[model samples]
Every structure is written in C-alpha cells, then in structure tokens.
Target chain A: MVETFGRHIRQSLGQLSYAAGFQLFLFKETFNFLGKRRIGLRVLILQILFTGVEALSIISLLSLGIGAVIIIQGAQLPDFLLGEQLYRILIIVIARELGPLLTAFVIIARSGSAITTELGNMVVSHEMEAYLSVGIHPVSQLGVPRLIGMSISMFLLTVYSNVFGLLGSLTVSSIITRVRLADHLSALFANFYLVDIVASIAKSFVFGIIIAATSVYYGFSVSGAITEVPVKTIRSIGVSIVLCVIADGIIILLTMLVTA
Target chain B: MIDVPIVLDDVTIRFDGRAALDGLSLEFQRGKSTAVIGSSGSGKSLVLKCAAGLIFPEEGDVLFEGRSIATMGEREYQQMQARTGFHFQDAALWANKSLGENLSLPLLAADPDLSDYALHGKVAESFASVKLELDPSLRPAAISMGQQKMVSFLRATISRPEILFLDDSLSFMDHAGSRQLMARIEEFKDAGATIIIATHNREFSGRLADRVVVLSDGRMVASGPYQEVMSSQDPALLPVLRDLV
Candidate 1:
C-alpha cells in the first residue's frame, strides 16, 4: 500500500514536471507563431474574449460588494483614526491581497474548467490525433493561445478588480464619512504605493500560469475514453483551485519578505 | 519532400499486457501501393498507424528511408507530416471545425502562404472532386456518416500528400461514394503517392494493391507480390487469405 502511494506521488510529480516544460515550450512557440500566423492570433483573441470580457460582470459585482462592506465597517473606528484606517485597509485588502485571489478563484471556477472540458472532449473525439496527422502541433496551436490568453485575462481582471474595488469604497466613504473630500482623496492616493500594483501583477501572473497549465495538461491527459473526459475535468478543476490558493499564499509571503 | 520507402523493423505494440502487433516487420516501397488485410484483432490498422508515425513500437523502429522516425528532428517530422495524409476508420473529422475548416487546415498547414481566395478555390475544387454539395459551414456532427467519411477523404487528399494512409476508409461510403473515392485514390496513385491502406474489402485491395500483407493474431502470415500471395498453398496462410484468394 505504501509502495502504491509512493508510485502515485511519483507519477503526479512527473506529470507536473512534464506539463511545466510543455507550457514553457508552448509559450515560445505560440509567440513565434503569433508573428507569422493569423490563425493563431485569431484563436488568442477569442480566448481573451471568452475568458476576460465575458467575466467582467461577476468580477465587478463581487469587488463592489467587498469594497462597500470594508468601508461601512471601518466607519465604526474612532473618528480621528477612521479616515486613515479606511484608506490603508482598502489598499491592503482590495489591492494587495483579495483582488488577485478572488479574481483567480473566479477564473478557476470558470475558464479553467471550461478549458479542461473542451480539450478533454477534443481528445475523446480524436481531434488531437487529427491535428497531429495534419502537421499541426496541438500544444503550439491550442495550448499557447490559452496560456497567453488566461495570463493576459488574469492580469487585466486583477487590475479591473482594483479599480472597481477602490471606486466602491470611495463612493461609500463619501456618503457616510464627514471627512473633507480633499483629505480623503489625498489619503487614499498616499496609502496606495507602486509596490501594491506590482504585487497584484506578480500574483495574477503566477496564478494564471498555474490555472492555464493545469487545465490544458488535464485536458490532454484524457486518453482513449469518453468517460475519462469528466474525470479529467474534475481533476483539473480541483488541482487548479488548490494550486491557485497555494500560489496566492506564497506570493503574499514573498512580497511581505521583500518589502520588509 | 518525404523520403520513401517506410520500413518497420520488428515492430511490437502492446495494450493492457496483450500485444496488438507482435514482432511484425514490413517495408513499403516508393511510388507503390500496399494493402494490409486481417481479421478483427489482427493489427492491420496498427501497422498503418505505426508506419504513419502516429504510434511508436515497443520492440523496434519505423524508418522513413534509413532514418528512424523515433528520433527524427522536428523540422523533418513536420515535413513528413505535411507530405503525408491519413484517413481514419471512423472519419475522425474535427468536431468543432466546419467541413471547410477541416479541409482548409491541412491545406493551410502544408502551405500557409496560400491566399484565402486560393484556399477557397482549392476547397471548392476538392468538394467538386467528390461531387459533395454540402455546405462548407456544416460541422461533422451535422453531416451523415457517409458524408463525414467523404469530407474526411477530401481533407486527406486536399493537399495531395505524397504518402497516404487510409484505414477502412470506405466503411461508411455507398456505392457511388466509394467509386468517387476509389477514382480519386487512382489519381493519387497515378501521381506517384505511396498508398497504404487497412481494409477488409478484398476486391478493393485486389484491384489496387501491388503487394498484400495478411495478418493473423498480430503477426504477418503472408506477404508478397499480390498474385503470388493469393495463390500460395501454405496451410497457415489459407484461413486468413480464404476470401481474398
């Protein structure tokens, strides 16, 4: 039993190693092809449209709600400290941490699973073999676009969350607090540093890689059976969520270390 | 251009501890037609797939000319792929792409510089070759099995590949459709594309095969010039060759 567990762990590690290498190669090939092939660029555009643009509604709504709650709760602080605490809390919660994490969760629930299912179905239907026989490399053609698209989407969505999130708290603060408008605006700008934006970008990029690579790898892992499609899809979704969460924690810890 | 003949040296493939192809070796000559015939589990399709570099063998190597395909460079492999075409037993058309895109993909891969107008012209020309009038926009699921097979045939031949592998390609075709594909196959042969097919149709194989390989239980039982193999008196080859002989 122990041996079996060890073997499973070994297999999982090997799979992850192979997937990381494949994604790196895919990234190079996708960009190389992007310059020469219109077809690849078109696929990248469609991926961004489906993964980023279509997801804006839920992202905006969630950010708005979270930002408002933080403001209303911060208002309970002693009057003199309320103004400064509000901006610092908002920047920390909305910009540095929650914004990237929540956006990643949304992508894991949405685009990651969809990518896995779509590729898994393609594998089941022999479309991948068809691609190979026809001289098209599946990883270069299908994978790179999705990787670049998800990373691009993740970066954009995280920024969008920051914008909508701050706007949300600002609007709520204007209504509830008697702090002068000029002071509030200045405090908000002062509390927000360049490192926060950089942190968001770093967190989003790492999360995007984890999700896209995990999904595409599982999708192609569906071998020879229609039943395997759903199995792989579930595995893809589960692994993506776990990895994203772990990555979010690590990025937070690293950034904290760096700034300290 | 792809080099020929394709040689399989003592190839073996196993699935779930059972050998699908066991120590089978065959060589396909340039500009010639070879047919692989066998019973249900006899590995005829396995031979074609191995030859096409789709499946690697456990025991030995498949070589294009003298170079092992197992270790071939990417540029060279891509060249072989562009120069070769395979028709699957189940049609295996892309589910998401339209029939037009299915045909266009192979053509585009072969020559990415082809203009869109020229690409459509070529697609239309191939559709005309088969006399298939279905919309190019129809997905594989939207078409009948026979129509799917025809589109598959068109896609395989769209680029006029120098090496062609067809696996039970006529399974879903009717009399007229089969005739259309056979005529096209003849044109491919006439143009010097090496033709390798796995089929149960003795008449089709007998008519086109310059040589025949009979497989039984994942091993080659008989292989020779078409007429020589057909007339052999060996008892071991008799059962597999009964109908063909």
Candidate 2:
C-alpha cells in the first residue's frame, strides 16, 4: 500500500513538472514566432474583437454598478467627510484592484474557455497533426497571435473599466450629493496617481498572458479523445483563474513596496 | 526539392505506459516506394510520424539525409518540413478554415511570397490531379467524408514534396475516389518521389510498394521486397497477406 501511494505521488510530481515545462516552451516558441504571426494578423484582430470589443457592454455595466455601490455605501461614512474619502476609495478599487481583476475575469470566462475547447477539439480531430505534418509549428501558428491579442485587449479593457467606473461614480455623486461634475473630477484627480495606472496595466497584462498560455497549453494537452476536450477546458479555466489571482497578489505586493 | 532517405534506427514509442512501437527499425529509400503493413494499433502510423518528426521516438533516432533529426539546425528542419508531406489516417482538415485557407497554409509557409493567383492555381491543379472540383470557400464540414479525405491528400501533396508519407491513404473513399487517389499516388511514384505508405489495403501494397515492412504487435516481424516477402510463406506473412487480403 505504501509503495503504491509513493508511486502515485511520483507520477503526480512528474506530470506537474511536465506541465510547468510546457508553459515555458510555449512562451519561448511564441517569442520566436512573433514576426511570423504578422502574416495572420486577421486572427489577432478577431481575437481582440471577441475578447475586448465584444465584452465592452457587460464590462461597462458591471463597472458602473460597482462604482454606484461604492458611492451609496460611502454615504454611510458619518457625514460631509464622504466626498474626500469616497474619491480615494474609488481610485484604489477602480484603478488598482477591481478594474483589472474584473476585466480579466470577464476575459477568462469568455476567451480562455473558448481557446481551450477549440484547440482541444483540433487535437482530437488530428488537425494538429495535419499542421505538424506540413512543418508548421502550432505554437507559432496559433499561440503567439492569441497571447498578443489577449494581452493587448486586457490592458485596454482595464483602462475602460477605470474610465467607465469614474463616470458612474460622477453620475451617482451628482444625483445623491448634488455635487457638481467639476468637484468630483478634481477630487478623483487629486487621489489618482501614476502608480495606480501602472499597477492596473501591469496586472491586466500579466493576467492576459496567464490566461492565454494556460488555455492553449491545456487545449494541446488533451490525450486524443473527444471526451477529453471538456476536461481540459475546465482545467484550463481553473488554472488560468488561479494563476491570474496569484499574479495579481504578487503585483499588488510589488506596487505597495514601490509606493513605500 | 531533392529526395533523401528516412531511416528509423530501432525506434520505440510508448503510450499510456505501454510500448506502442518496440525497437522498430526500417529505412525508406530515396526515389523508392515502401509500404508498412500491420494490423490496427501495430504502430504503422507511429513509424510514419516518427520519420516525419511529428512524433519523436522514445529510443533511437530518425535519420534524414544521413543525419539524425535531433542534430539538424532549425533552417534545415524547416526546409525538410516544407519539402516532405505526410497524409494522416484521418482527413484532418482544419474545420474552421475554408478549404482554400486550409490548402493555402502550407503553400504560404513554404513560400510566403506566393501570389494569390498562383496559390489558387496550385490548389486547382491539386484538385485537377484527382479529377475533382471542390469549392475553396466551403469549410470541410460542408463536404462529404470521401471528398474531405481527397482534399486532405491534395493538401499533403500540393506542395509536391520529394518525399511522401501516407497513413491509411485510401480510407473513407468510394471505389472511384480510391481509383483516382491510387492514380495520383502512382503519378507521385513515377515522378521518383520517395513514398512510404502505412496501410492494410492489399492493392496499395501490391501495386505501389517496391518493399514491404510487416509489423505485428509493435515490432517488425518481416521486411523485404514486396514480392519476395509475399511469397516467403512465413507464418507472419500468412497473417499479413491474408489479413490484408
């Protein structure tokens, strides 16, 4: 029994090591194929369209709603002190934390699963073998464009979340406190810093790459069965979310250190 | 492209912790045709993939042009991939792509500067070789299974590689389609391209192959010229000859 348990642990560790190695391989291959992927720019455009542009309405709605909630709850903070404290809170939440994280969540649910399912099905159908048979590298042909597209889209969408959230906060302050748009703007501008923008961009960009790599890696991991497609897709999304959050935490720590 | 021999030096592969290929060694000579005959799961496709560098063997080397593929430079490897074709057992067309895009991928990879007109002409020529008309704009799902297989063949051979590796070449075809495919393979054969076919079809082996490699249970049980191997009357030959028939 002990020997069987030990063998199982060894096998698990071996698989974990292989999976980590493959992610590095994908990154290296993507770098090598960056110039080559320009010929297929249509794929990158479509990916941005789907992951960024298409998700604009939902992201706007969610950001606006979150912004309104923060304003309403700030009304509870004991008096006229709400205006000063609220704008700072908005900057922290919308720019440094939730803006990037929420945009990544939206992208993960949409593009990450789609990538995994598409690539996994290709592997099952032997389309990957067909691509390889002709001497085309799958990472270059598929992964590079996706990684670039997702990261670019993620960075831009996080900026949108920050902008739209501020707009929503402005509208709420006007309705509830009768504060002028100028006063709200001045307050937000006073609190917002260059570091907040950098942190948001950094977090979203890293999340984009994490999602793309994890999804594509798992998609290619399906071991030749149709049933494995869904399994790998689920695994891709789970790993991508975990990696994104862990990355987000690390970036948050770094930004704090820089500010300190 | 000039032709070169592909030698599998005692190649072995494993799947799910079991040996899929066990020290199987064979050579496909330049400008010659060889057939690998075996039962299903006998590692016929594995041998073709190993030789094509699509699947690396766990042990031993796949040597192309007298050098192990492991030692080849990126440019050298790319040149060979651009010049060698391997038709998979399944049709394996990219379902999302229009048939034109599917055929255009390898052509573009080989020569990115190829003109649009020239690309269409090359694709048309491949279809014309098999005496079929397929609209390039249509996806693979819109085509019949036999037609998909034909397109797969044309896609593989459209680049006109000097070496051809075909796995289950005539699968999912009608009698007429099979005949047309066979004629096309014969054309490649006569053009002096080195051809390696992994098939159970008696006719493909009997008509196209000069040498036969018989595999059973992941090992090479017999190898020789087709006629000599067929007439050997060995027990392994019985199964290969009968099961193939």
Best by TM-score: 2
Worst 10 residues of 1 chain B by lDDT: B236-245
Residue-level lDDT of model 1, residues A120-239, one tens digit each, is 888876778788888777877788788889999999999999888888878788777655656667889988887787888999899988899889888888877889988888898889
lDDT of 2 by residue, A136-203 (tens): 77766777778888999999899999898888877887888787888888888988889988898899
| TM agreement with the true structure for every prediction | 0.91, 0.95
DockQ scores for all the models shown? 0.65, 0.65
Worst 10 residues of 2 chain B by lDDT: B1-10
Per-residue C-alpha lDDT of model 1 across residues B66-153, encoded as one tens digit per residue? 8898898767877888888999888989887789999998887877888999999999999998788989998999989999989998
* Model no. 2, DockQ: 0.65
True contacts kept of 2: 0.60
